[model samples]
Target: MKWLGVLLAVAVAVIVIYKVNYPSYSYRYRLQVSIAVDEKIYTGSSVIEVVWDCGPKIAGLGRCAPSLGGPATLIDLGAHGVIVATLRSGENISPTPDGAIDAVWLCASAFGYRSTNEELPALPHLTGRRNLSVSNLPRLVWFVNPADMKSAQKVTFLNVASVFDPTAHFTEAFVEITRDPIVVDIPNKLPWFSELRRLQKEGKGTLSKSGQFQLVYNMFVGENS
Candidate 1:
């Protein structure tokens, strides 16, 4: 009886340690991209999931880290497409008090270099910080290649649209961020099975809804590739 009690205590301690160090919390969002070439537009979207794991700190030596999940192929414009565009979400994860995402770094780039061997001019590129909680939802950020502008100027949220010329030789890009809801379904297997069954009993089981930020962009390619 004493040996059985000892084994049970050790098993309980091991479970507690595993739950503390191995379990992870995650935040998910979607990234969508659209490119316009001539009269047709090509669009694609992918889910961006960030998982945070709290590591065991050995004398304060270890730190928590975040892992990102998404499709390996972001989007394939097409074989005959004139423009190539990409959207990337930063790995920096900082959640708000209400468990929502606070802010994230977003970067977008669009160019027409893939379709031609000719050395094209500078393309549209932008990297900026987006505040999700306090800022207005569905905010738009625009970018224009410096080669298209006659005068050198910085693009801001208010004056970015003015810099873009519809008849330019290069491509112009516009990125927007919006709040969308996503449903996360926990699988009934391994460590999550017990938690899933518990939630199932409360009618909150298989699926849980969470907020997601949809980062969508539109890139317009001019004729001169």
Candidate 2:
């Protein structure tokens, strides 16, 4: 009888904490990242947990957590383009108020279309395995949805090259979707690598150098209860 009472109390506490702390709506996004370098391909994956925050339903909504600095980074939710969240990366890099996300996606697209009408070299491409012709960067747009809490999401520096500085190297990239995040180790010859090797041997793909490529893919699992 005593043990049953204790179990019930603990269960109630857990529910309360989750309700208060976790976002009203949340989803787990699994991202598989990979790259093509020097005719070889290497890959890895990261899990992005996202939360949405819906501020007061009013026009010209005021900023959240002003003392923390300025307004949190905001992105447009896909459907209505509803603005959401003060975005931050898993590394705690706070999102900038500027439209950096849009800019990065833009630059990630076609290159050499200049403001001055001069010909320039094109930018590297981010391809989708299922749809290779167009850039796969749009897959990342889901992050803009608002959540009450921040997701532990990570986007590698290489992909962020468009928005961030120190631009260098041309690389072909793709994302292989997954239900959950995977830990890819190079030395152990994991299952993922086995497939990579098979692809390479069959002339379907190239082997990636260690730490050369980052694989990221995502699936929208059901919302939090």
Best by lDDT: 1
All candidates: TM-score:
0.34, 0.27
Best by TM-score: 1
Candidate 1 lDDT over 1-225, as tens digits, reads 999999999999999888665554444345454444444555544443434455564656345454444321122334431121222211123432223221122211121122111121111221222322222112222212212211212222223234432321212223233234432221211123345445555766333122322221111111111
Model 2 Cα lDDT, one tens digit per residue, 1-225: 999999999999998776554313322333333333334444433433333333332455421110111112222223312121111211112242222221222222223222111111122122222322233232232122223112213333345334212332224332222245423232131123345445544666432223222121111111111
Each model's number of backbone clashes? Answer: 0, 20
Indicate the TM-score of model 1.
0.34
